[model samples]
Structure formats: C-alpha cells, structure tokens
Target chain A: MSDFLFKRMTLIGIGLLGSSIALAARQKGLVEHIAIHTRSQATLARAEELSLGDSYHKDVADSVKDADLVIVCTPVGACEAVAKAIAPYLAEGAIVTDVGSVKASIIRQMQPYLPKTVHFIPGHPIAGTEQSGPDSGFAELFINRWCILTPPEGTDAAAVDKLAQFWTVLGSNVETMDANHHDHVLAITSHLPHLIAYNIVGTASDLEMVTNSEVIKYSAGGFRDSTRLAASDPTMWRDVFLHNKEATLEMLGRFTEDLTALQRAIRWGDGDTLYELFSRTRSIRRSIIDAGQEVDASDFGRHIVEGGETRAEQLKSDDHKDTGS
Target chain B: MSDFLFKRMTLIGIGLLGSSIALAARQKGLVEHIAIHTRSQATLARAEELSLGDSYHKDVADSVKDADLVIVCTPVGACEAVAKAIAPYLAEGAIVTDVGSVKASIIRQMQPYLPKTVHFIPGHPIAGTEQSGPDSGFAELFINRWCILTPPEGTDAAAVDKLAQFWTVLGSNVETMDANHHDHVLAITSHLPHLIAYNIVGTASDLEMVTNSEVIKYSAGGFRDSTRLAASDPTMWRDVFLHNKEATLEMLGRFTEDLTALQRAIRWGDGDTLYELFSRTRSIRRSIIDAGQEVDASDFGRHIVEGGETRAEQLKSDDHKDTGS
Candidate 1:
C-alpha cells in the first residue's frame, strides 16, 4: 500500500456511507488504520465479517480514539446522538466530517456536542444507490461523482483542504459551500426529486382502479423510472425530510405550484403551454449530458437486441423515428 | 426473407413510432410493400433517404391505396385529420390501427371518419425512448414490450386478431382492453408520469436561486432520472395530455393529494409516515423487476468504468452499499 496521509481514520456508523468510505480509503491507501463503529451489535459483527475496517467497535467513543480523521456516516436524525456519544474520546486536531444529505441541520445537531479542538466540516457526497448495508458498498461508488463539503465559517482552512484531499483521493470531485446553502441546493436537486418519486409511485400503487399488478406489468411506460428513487432507503429519506424541513417544504411548494399549473394546462387543452414546458426540460437533460453528469442512455440504456456493438453502431442500425405528421 | 403477412402495409406518419413499425415490419417480412406518407415533403424526403419504406408518398391517400394493413402512427392531435385523409382510400376489409398513448380520444376522433369496411383498432405500444424522429426508429423497438390494442365494442374479432398477430410478430406481448379503460390505465402508467417528469425538470430549470449550470452538473442525484422522461418529444406528450385530459387530470388530482400529505409529513417531521410511504414504494419497483417490466439496474445502469462487460457483471462488481446507518 502507498504511504498513508493519516495514521487512523474512524467511521462512526458502518452503514452504506461508512463502509463505502472505509473501502474507498483502504483501496486508495489513504489511512493506515480504519476503525468502524455502529450502534447495533449485529451490524458491527457484519462489518467485522466484511472486513470493512481494521477494528470494529461496539462503543462509539472507542472508535474515535486516536483517529486523525473521524467521519460520522449516519442518517441526519441520528447525527446528534452520534456527536454526543463520540465527543469526549475524539483526538485533538482531528477533522470531523459527515456524509449526511442535509447539512445545516447536521451542523446544528452536531456542533454542540463536538469539542472545539476538532475541526467540524459537514459534507454530503452526491452519490449512492437504492441498495443498503455494509455488503452494498464498493470502493468505486464515488468515482467521478461530486462530494460537496459544507464547512461552517471559521473552520480551519487547512482541515478543509485535508478533507478535500481525502475525498479527491477517493475519486470524488469536491466542491465546498455554506451548510445552509448546501441544504437549499440539495432540497431542490436531491430531496424534492426523491419525494416526488416516492409520491408518484405510492399514488400508482394505491390506485383502486389500476391493480398494483398491472402498474408493475406496464411500468416500462415512465412509472418505472420514478420507482428507482422511491426504492431508496426509507429511514434515510425520512430523516432527510425531517431535518431539512423548511427547505424541503419550500422546494415542494414550488414544485406543487408548477404541477398545478401543468394540471390546469392539461385540463384546459392548452397544448402549446404543455409543449413549451416539455420542450424546455429537454435542454436540461442535454446540459447534464454535456456537463458529464449524465449518460445519454435512452430508456435507461436497456437494449433490446444484445450484440457486441457500440452505442453508436446500435443507434445506426436501430435508428429512431420522431418526424411525423 | 420470410412469408409476408400482408401484400402492402401503409404507415400514415413516418415518425418515431411509424418508422419503427416500418423497420420492424421489414425485418420480420410482415409486409411485402411498405408505403410511408407524411404531409411534410421534407420529412418524406428524409424518410426516403433513411429507406424507412418501399415508397414515400406526400399524398396521404396514395400511401393507403390498396394497402391491406394501415397504421396511423402520428401525434394524438392529428388522429382526426389523418383519419379523414385516409378514410376514402383505405382498402375494403383492411385492418387499420394507430399507435397513440391516449386511445379513447383517438377512437372518438377517428372512428366516425373511418369507413365501416375497415377495422379501426386503436393500439398503444408501451415502449419508447426519449429520442424521436425518423432517424430514431429501430427494428427491435417493441421487443418484449406490451402493446395495448383498444378495439371498439363491435370491432370485427377476425380483424382484431390479425392486428394482434401483426404486433406479436413485431415482438410485442399483446393485450386487448376497452378504449376508456385503456385511457385510464395509461394515464396512471404513462401520461401522469411524463407530466410529473416534465414539471419537475422545468421547475429545476426555472429556479432562480439555483443556477441552471449547477442543477445540470449535480443532476445525478435523482433529478437526471426525471429528465429522461422530460426529454421525450414535446409534441407527442402534449397530444397525450390534451387528448387524455379527464384521465390525466384525475390521476394528477390523486398525485397532488398524496404529495400534499407527503409535504405535511415532511413539514411536521412525521418520519414514520414518510418512512412507511417510502418503504411501500420499494416493493412496487421489485414487483416491476420480478414481472420482467424493468431491469434491476441501479442508477439507470450507467456504467462509469469502461469495459466490454455485461450489465450483470458490472452490477456484480458494483454491489451497491445501501444497508448502513
């Protein structure tokens, strides 16, 4: 392994984010020793079985002792408890960070318990999947994805730089913003999309006229796409909505207003209005593709005819027909 | 290539659906001669250039003359106009169908114009990508997908069987339902989803506080999934909403009510409600996968690591880390 930047790295929740960090850190040789801790004995045992860290600790304080970097990887609802549990044993000069989706609330809940000696840098890696648990993690989860660090003002610049370096080493493109701003941005970008997905999927499933079986059978027509986000961890999302309440509500309000107008347009037979809104959204997807944030895979890249061929070749042979009457 | 099902098959619009039908029909040797017609001479020339049909006709009537099977593959808004144009020329005892998402409205628009000798079955294939136009058509577009045919109450059973068989040959699993039921089913499964996608994408783009560039750059955090549907053809989607107004509005009403409750849950910090709703939606996604409607591809199956590897292998290596704190 390459020379380590830190003598020890402690992860204070060996779940998806924690285990992923451990695996990523170990893969990159960023830390000499990795300590993993979770509240549950079964999960600690599971982490141990997976070899997610050098040491598996049942006690939260024990996990943070002597670590140069300690990352709290938990749902936002649990951040305060984790902060209080680990405060006394944390090493001086250690950088404290988190992988929670909400930032301002995490900062609010955590800052009180964390000692002044440690540098508290709140972070959120814009990466994950619907699957969960220690076994779900892989070293390459964060590769090329953005890991946003939302460090409070007056936090040591050196500590922030070190944390950025750590994420860069783990293959993330890092960006920093204020914790409140991060919460607002994520409310629109991540939280709202997830809520809408869950809402629509739930609506479809609960319909009395449309059988749940039929909804599933014919989901290839648009509904299935929303289900991916809906399939995400419920607890994590629940915690997200609870902690980021104001911002999430603000974005949700805006979304509902827009949706209502759209509903009206459809109701009134306003095809022009509908067409304009639909046309405008296409450019955003294009921008995402151009910015390297998304792959230009049509139908979630599910190919009908499998062959040893490039997408270009496949598109050439399987040309699309949009031009019409 | 193989024994033909019909001597001539006329496609009344050479767009995405129409051209795909042409390509698939040609590939399966379902028809000996494919006559494609569009009002736009430019589109007709382009269709000719793509060789999407045996003959490209500017006159709609010329395309349907002597054709045993005629398919109207155009936007729903154009159904009445196309029906009127092709009614006089449709061969006696010919089976005619249209692939439009909203079947009830299309039936109302076209049925009165269509001659009694021709069987006008309204069909909708639950298959498509966001990409459209003549160049986007593929021979395998409908492979392993559902195609719903909404026949009128007194439609000739023999004619319906022939049309169903034609779709089966195109690699679609066929189902027959009444026009009104089909509209309701599709509004939930297809129309509503597209509207939500478009609305959300538009909301993100219209946000003044969040830069469009930032939204695009960080779209992978669930927003990009919606964008895929949002990027679909505006004209087609507009027609869907306009024609299926009642069903779309009903579904939209249900969706809005659910969303309002969800918004309240988030605002009031009712984590249990949020958790339960989120948890419930996951099973629907699983059902979709189990029922062979969706592939279990995490993150739309976008592979970051370049390789000559199958998605199963990629998923195996990228075993997701969802289970954690």
Candidate 2:
C-alpha cells in the first residue's frame, strides 16, 4: 500500500505560494511526484534551479496530464484562464484547487471550467511574506498558519478531507467555511489592511510639508509597520482588490467611517473618545497573541535581530549584498 | 575631569521612554547620578525595584534639585504641569529636554514655565514598541534611532550641542530642526500612522458580519501588523493626538483624501491604479531599511521566531509563563 497522499501532484504557477507549496509538500513527503508549470520561462527555470519539483512543464495542460492533484497558484485574475487550460487534462478523481485570496470570485471564475469528474476545492493559505518569486519560498512558511478551504457545496466529502489532509501535512490548521463568508472574513482581516497600508505610504510620500527622507528617517515611530504590508506583491494585491471588490469596499467603507470619527475627535480635542478607542483596540492585539496568530515579542521581534548587530555592522553586511560598481 | 556628561540627571516620569533613558544613560556612563520621579508612587516604586536610577524621589521638585540634565518624560498633556513643578528647582545652566512626540506643543507647554537660566530643548526619540510602562524599556531602545531636538531660537548653541552629545552617546543619531517643522514631520510619520492603526483595529472589532474571534484567528493575513501599533499606550497616544492637533489633523486630512481615491479605485476595479500605488509604496520600505530605520527581514522577521519553534512548543512555553491555578 502506498503511503503517499497522491501518486502525482502538479503546481500550475511558480511564485511565492506555488514554490512554497512545492517545497513544503516535498519536505513532508506528501506526494510521490510533483510537476511544476508556469508560462514565464524565467520562473520555470528558476524553480528548476531551486529543484522545487520532480518535473517542470512550460505547457499548462501537459503539467496536469494524469496528475491526481493540481493546485493553481496564480493571481486571482488569471485563475479563469488557468482553469480553462488545465480542465481538459486533469485525471479523473483529481482534486483541483487554487490558492487565491478571494474565494467567492475564485469559485465564480474557476468552478465552471473545471470538469465534473474532479473535485474542486478553493483554498487560501493565510501565509506569506512581502517578498515574492521562487527564491522567497520556504517549507516552514505554512507552519502554524491558517489555511482556509472553501469547497463548494455538494462537493465530495472524501476529496475535501483528502485536500485538507494535504494542507495538514504541510503544517497548516485547516478550516472550511462558506465561500462568501470567507470573502467577508478576509476582507476585513486582509484586504482592507493592505489597502490602508498602501494608501498611507502613498500619502506620506506625496506630502509637501514632510519630505520623504524625513518620513523614512522617523518611520520606526509607527509608519514602518505599515510599510511591511505596503511592500507586498503589487500584482497580487491589485488582483485581490479587483476580484474581492464587494467585501473589500464594504470593509473599506467601515474603516473610513471609523477613521472619520477618530479624526473628528482629534480635531475637536476629545481626549476621552480617543483614549477609549485606543485603549479598547489594545486588547485585540493581546487576543491575537494569545490565539497564537501573532508573535508575542514586541515590534514583531525586530529588536532581537537589531540588538544582535550594531547599525554600522548591519550596513556593512548590506553593502556586501549590493552590486559593486 | 569625570567622564560623565552631567554630574546629575533627572527623569520626571518613569515610563517606557523615561526608563529607557535611565538605562541607556547609565549603560553609556554619561550620567554620574540618575534621579527618577513620577506622580504615581506605584510606578516610582517599580522603577526603584528595577534599579533604573541611582535615586528615586516622590516630589518632582526634589528630583530636579541640583540636576544638570532634566528630561520630562511624561505624556505631552502633562508637560505643562511637570514643567511648572520642576522649574523652580532646576539648577542654573541645566539643559531641560523632553521625549514628547509633538515638538511644537511640547515647546508651547513647557517653555514658558522654564527659566531662561536653563536651556529648553524639546526632543523626540523616534523609536518605540507597542509595549509601554517601566518593564517595557531596554538600553538598546535608542540604538540606531533618530532623536529630533527642537531647541528654540537664540538658545545657547553650546547647550544644544551638549544635549545632542548626550543623545549621541546613548546610540542615537541626533538632528536639530525647527520645533514646528519637527511637529509636521512627526505628524505624518508617527501620529497619522497610529491614528489609522487605531481606527482600523476599531473597525475590525466592530464588524457585524465578522466575529472578533475570526479576526483574531486569521489576523496573520495582514491585520496583525496594525495591531502592534494599536496596542501602544492609550494615555500616551491620546496626548499625542490632542497636543499635535493642527499638524496631525492636516496629515489626517491628506491621508483620508488619498485613501478615498484608493477606495474609488477598488470600487471601479482600476487594477492599473492599484498596481501603480502598490508598486511605488514598496520603495519606501526599501529606503527605510537602507536608512537603518527598519529591519531588513521579511515580515519584520517574525518568521525567524516562529520557525525557531513549533506552534505546540510555543504554546507550551507560553503556558509556563501563565499563572498556575
């Protein structure tokens, strides 16, 4: 009897998520063979260099041929085209899934094109760093992180469990929810936060009174935290906002309303109101830390890295990484 | 002949910044004696227990008597009262400074009460974590950080240089700028970011469609980053918004305007606009990292800590910290 979850597993894109899944699946020995595919030859070559899969395919259909599992790891906007291209080649009883931030739209875009013979489970591993591309992948990226699966209603239960088991082996805590509800939950938790980070960084850059240098110099005060999220992959975030329009806008509306009220309190010098809101928001951070969703260290443990090395030493190390003229 | 910068140094509040200053100054051997005071006897006792200072005083006036350096580390809202209490006792030629977030307001609040015999330099060290209080301070807190000193015009340049040297010895890069200009810079860099963070956390917690538990569970997606800033001291942040009202409101208006445009882009599915804004903001983070204002690691290096231990192991360690029933 085979111990592997599947005899063949194919990845349809080779970016941060795709490469990470490849590394993680192999590290856990979850699949017997892994096939990687991407339209960009540069990425495909890089994945091959990284040895992220057992085989690399430039053609999307060839990548999934006879594969028992196919995971599409493209930007949400490209999911429909990928679904169409790989739909015909997927083996019978194959579990097809895509890792997209917006699940409802992913279902809307990919579900119709997928064959009825295969199980379609839309999943989002709520795990990533600001860095992108093949080199950014690491097997430990999913450890202790949440991977949400939004399998469509009436989907095969056994197939859903199989996919969940795969994510579980990769060290993720799996949860299943209605696709629309997942969209709403993620809108407030993920999309709105990224939108706000990008918007603030733009505002700080464009300010006439405060030069960008000054902003950068003093960013440790608070602004640097926003920059981490703002530095995420532009194409991916753009696709997320476009695909998750309704929930994103709804959450953004609420955020703006709350901000307006806070603005009024600041302008009117309502110290009590400001104090109340600021005080209440603090507990949520404690709750997150308690829930093990956040690092318990202050400033996300940046100080540990910083305190380990002096500024001059850090600069010298960074200079070594820079290209010499 | 002594190597110490000052024969006596006094801190008027024993909070995060105050305690950090005590630790850093002592660590650098810049002060021969450190005197600490706070209105709260509990905090003063706590500081004494921590041995953060050479002497502890219950009376603010007594703390500054014979002190050549007095730094009022109280909230900006309490600066006027602290200045009034300590002015009569501050030694002649003593350089009085503050670590308030709002420079102009600190000047307005404390300058009038200070005697001309002493130099009043309003300073803000642009570094902190979300945690506050006496226990939340470290000697390395000011290392590689920028400390802005806003000394009023015609004040003795010698005294300004002396204070600047003091901060530099404590591992800070000190910059002298006009008080109002410092306020404007910090309004954009620090105050507005905190406001937005506090606002977003508030919005997330109040969502009717999304449970707070769900928000906490999946916060690793992006929302968790904002929580760090929102977790900062409520009393300190309240005073910052109240004291830095004009510049903060101006920056808040700009931020809101920019965010509104981004909101419109999302609503209209303007992918190009979103992509452009997202792509451009990434460079700011890179600049900050280059400037040594932020950690260069991805996700602020949270992964390093997480990858060091499995979730179950981390939970076990955390349980050890909890009080046993």
List candidate 1 segments past 4 Å from native.
A304-325, B304-323
lDDT at position B42, candidate 1 = 78
Model 2 spans > 4 angstroms off: A309-325, B309-325
Tell me the lDDT of model 1 at A52: 88
Pick out the ten consecutive residues of candidate 1 chain B with the lowest summed lDDT.
Answer: B304-313
After best superposition, candidate 2 residue B269: deviation in angstroms? 1.6
lDDT of 1 by residue, B207-287 (tens): 877888888777767788889899888888888888889988999999999999998887777888998998888778777
True contacts kept of each: 0.77, 0.72
> Local error of candidate 2 at A49, Å?
0.8
Maximum-DockQ candidate: 1
Pairing residues by index, what is the TM-score of model 2? 0.95
